[model samples]
Target chain A: MMDKIIRDNYQRETKIIDAVYPRTYRDSTIVHSDRLQCVYDVFTYTGDRLNDEGVKMNLMFLHGSGMNRFIWDYYVAHLLDYKLGAAINKIVTLDQVTHGDSSVLNRGKLGVGYDWSDGARDACKVAQKEFYSGLEDNSDDIINIVVGHSMGGFQAMCCGVLLPSLFDFIVTIEPVAYSPNVPNNSNVTVLPPKFFKAIASKVEDEFKNEAEYDKFMHERSFFTKTHPEIFERFKETERINMEDGSIRTKMERRQEMLCYMTLHPTSYWLLDGAKHIKVPVVSLVGGIATWAPKENQQVLQKSIPNYTVDVVPQGDHLMNIEMPDEMLKRLSVHFTKFAKEYQSKNYDNSNKSVARREEIFEEIYKETERNRVKNGKPVLAKL
Target chain B: MMDKIIRDNYQRETKIIDAVYPRTYRDSTIVHSDRLQCVYDVFTYTGDRLNDEGVKMNLMFLHGSGMNRFIWDYYVAHLLDYKLGAAINKIVTLDQVTHGDSSVLNRGKLGVGYDWSDGARDACKVAQKEFYSGLEDNSDDIINIVVGHSMGGFQAMCCGVLLPSLFDFIVTIEPVAYSPNVPNNSNVTVLPPKFFKAIASKVEDEFKNEAEYDKFMHERSFFTKTHPEIFERFKETERINMEDGSIRTKMERRQEMLCYMTLHPTSYWLLDGAKHIKVPVVSLVGGIATWAPKENQQVLQKSIPNYTVDVVPQGDHLMNIEMPDEMLKRLSVHFTKFAKEYQSKNYDNSNKSVARREEIFEEIYKETERNRVKNGKPVLAKL
Candidate 1:
């Protein structure tokens, strides 16, 4: 049934947006020249959509590091199955800056040391533009949910904290929400910045062809268990062709290394920012810990009062990629349950949600006004 | 001559400032309650002071972690010698937040994960209030020089970047301006967060009396070569006399650990922020590498075009604490050379410096006005 849905109607519109956020150092030194060009794909439901009374969801999917928006194509196709399709509105998945098409746009401007919060802000900007643009509120009717994997999972968590009123529910698959305070697995020695550089420097950048790249990836343990079709999808989405008929990874190795260095600050932010998250979050951890330890996962569960931890017995850090079927099953069950519960539950803050939306919109309008005034541009309205 | 000056003429007045800057996480989540209470001592020249024709100067001293402003007392006392005292007007030594008196004042409000940039800002606020407050510019007459050790040294470099027109020169003693891109000592494995926490947790926080601390510190290699008088000063400034007759360190173990975790970001910031620093910076590194590798020190020299590195033989990371005489000698020579050069050399941007000062003041005023408006206070000025 899922295959038929994907084959028949998996149409998507690609979005290219100029994200005006300037890159900044840890000391808040804003680099105005470094801008992120965000690229996302919106998969709108072509079939009969849900009515006004039914639960309508604008699902935002964020891919992990070294991945692009197209990674979610297979998963989005599965979401379109009749079991979850009735409530589907649109599925939006984005390529993080320095990944996929966005990397091509931000090539020379990419700065050293990526901050996960910036990634969160990037995601929020796109989400706000897509779902909450106007002054009129649409909170009680349409729900916005974020589904992310690995690094993206952590960004999803950040989204919940940055704008508490934006997201309805968050699903994180093996998120890197580690805290140094917690006791981690003894066997796994965390990589230092030096090691990160070494690893990135050693990565093979150029390949002869797609077939050659496939052969190389097949040898790696992480890719061995990945679904063959998904592996093919990765080859398509994760690499770009050169003029000389060679191919290279869309995400630069330097950018990937910066992402690794960013893991430290991300852990710190997660520990401190966890207390501010008011939305319900469901984290899927693997039985065998890979990057974030099992103990850290437990701490993460305890950190957020509304967070739940679900351990997949045979899965590891790359569970979503390696065991897509298992992840899809869990996701389907969760969506169905959440959708049903969401519709029946008495939300006392339904009115507050509308008011909060207006407040957010007003805040955005005021900021725009400030920028307009700063640039000496003509102002449309007074703040 | 140094001994005569120390015994007869050294006098200092202590000042406590309420640093209005709030504690913020890497994600920019500002914790307003966690404010820094800065404590500094202003040492006035009781002897014949330098006139406006001569080089009038304000030298600011900053100590390292597990230390206080008093660590510079011995060094400050020496600076009043006839060789350097003729040109010296005043010396100000400050205790960083979470150290000495400042730590006692900030006991309950210290947040986890310290950012070195905040430390720099704290120093800047104090320097600005003490030296650069009035609308009239004093850039030409009273040259501001910052002398910092270890963590404080890095913050000194940061001050140069934050307000380019504030300081004329910076002297850093074994600053932790490390970069992962540089080749570091292979023997030193960068301590992971778990190790930092473990180390902090294992630190001796309580002692029976001053004698016990002396005995404990005497056995440590870093303190073995420290002057006995300075060692006594350490006991006086580094620990707090508790109500229960027990002595505890002023800087909390948790805060110390946060300081360690911050080294990573400090390294990243120094690498990025070095280029923006227009002032001449002299970094006095130890011959034996301690926390930061010699290679990283060299990289620091390379990163800042005007930066110079001087290695002190027989000195380690605690060179300033262990061998104050050597550091003082270098400082005196540099100050004498700079003072003479500054008087003769024509600065074409003397007018620009005044303009820059006004620009900074206006920025501060606008920010304060915005905050006042946010808090519903009466507006005092226009942008």
Candidate 2:
């Protein structure tokens, strides 16, 4: 029924975009730029592209760690069938380099570890090529919104910062962003990255068969509350068949562990980089305190100038999978409100004035240069 | 002249105490505990131990990075000669491993990289053995005070947290502690750890002769304002005579680089560990902005419960060497005030009440455990 609804409401196309695997830190000029094909799904609306409000939103969905683009299958279907007051021209979903179909394509070409900024770089490229290729800046009626969960949620915010002009709005659900500045207000303290890495090291790599994998996942509490339909999609897309007919999870355990390890530094970078995001950001956090405390969401609200955090009742980290309807309701309300605001506000005010993000970036770059000491000599000597 | 004053006013003894080289992270129980000899110097006052105000104080001075206990020579001489309205029973100073004479003694036995908490552990063991050993809890008449500069300053705060009962006060001088929570009010943004590591890697490790080393150092602006006598002491004691008649800095360049790399994590750890410190902390910052920003000192002021930041006029990062008189005057005033306050306040109130630090530590430990997921199974499963 869900597949039929999705098939009838939208025209789906599997597309691949060129992406670069960055080598240097902070996306510095020194990059290998290993050309890889990043696979994504695009769903174009068959009905009226513009809603009653006469506004169109083009959204790109990004999955979290160890998950694939198909995790959004249920949510996308609901959005396409029930526009929920906001019109959608198209919806896009991505599979990260080492997850799902992208994992198979970039099997041996993957980098040693994940540089989170690389994800932002790839997403920016995709958004530019897919949505803004021939459109004039500020002329395109389509509002570009990037919605992501967990790790992808962090990347969505990064996308806004890396290219502030690209994204119009960003929605992150339970982003694994931790800031040292904020106190953990949950009942328990969040464990450090090392502990998560240790747990990742021990994740089940392979199963005898799909049924066995299903049984194993069902036993784990992390996926117990996942909607049955979403669970089926996750089980099908999150793993691949082995040569011997067994199955293995798409994301390598080592890669997952590496992702967990990079969480701290990358999260801190996001906290520092968030101030540059000139777009509105709304974070949908789980009301139920789980791995990520509710206060963790405040990191974005505190740093970003225009940011809000909404708590989904009885929702957990996997709220998108567990209660897609609740997430959809909040998304529709937020996108409608944001679309009206964007129409009323002078969106071109920033472009006419100084590009504050670029200015701040330049300021930070110069400041870093001035503070550096080279060869036992200070460039601008002080004390 | 300084040597004559120091020799006449105090009875000095070189002491060696046992210390452990921690191997595990966070000084976890899984440690090698490689036994090592930590060396220190004791300067017992020859005059009346108690001040006119009827208070006795025992002082321990810890040197900053790339420095030894001898860095305190001028400061110690001044303190011994002029009591500064306060009396001192004895003054002690330490040479951290890989920095001074201890570097030569512990040659080839040092651990790879630095675990900052190990410094606190060593200092705690030394404090308990030297000052508090055989003394009944809350019965010791001498108020123990620890004064550390830069890296040692950070360690002094750690010392207070690790064993709060040992030290009555902690004074940190332009400590290398940086917290992301504080807005760096200085004109420039401080360079990250990687930049410092690069600088450390390029430092001149070996000098042809003492005169060449002196000439090289004098050419750099970093040491231009250093007091001539203190600069002489620094040049003489900071380096060691090599086997080929050349001179090499006591601390290895690679070790120093590792120390720089560990600064970020260790500083964050200090921010978290600082709340546990029940004693008063005074951070002496340089009025002249140099490598360490004045706002960087505010990290301690914000996190620590009973902490204060004092700016020393015309002083920089190496204020202890550049303006020892200014540092000494502030120390005398702060210490004198602290001593009098300690005498008036109920010093044993915390001991009689709940041990808050231990309770917090246990709470964090249990929280970590509850939040940890082992073998794909959360101990206290949620979501």
Q: Any runs in candidate 1 off by more than 4 Å, and if so which?
A: A1-7, A26-32, A49-53, A133-139, A179-203, A346-383, B1-383
Cα RMSD, model 1: 20.9
Name the regions of candidate 2 deviating beyond 4 angstroms: A25-34, A81-85, A134-138, A179-194, A346-383, B1-383
Residue-by-residue lDDT tens digits, candidate 2, A64-116: 87778898878778875455445777788888776778776765445444556
Q: Supply fnat for every model shown.
A: 0.00, 0.04
User: DockQ for each of the predicted structures, in order?
Assistant: 0.01, 0.02
Kindly list the per-residue Cα lDDT of model 2 for residues B42-96, writing each as its tens digit: 8877855457765567788888766778879888788764454457767888887
State interface RMSD in Å for all models.
27.9, 24.7
Q: Best DockQ goes to which candidate?
A: 2
Q: Give the alpha-carbon lDDT of every model.
A: 0.65, 0.66
True contacts kept of 1: 0.00
Can you tell me the DockQ of model 2?
0.02
Best candidate, lDDT-wise?
Answer: 2
How high is each candidate's TM-score?
Answer: 0.46, 0.45
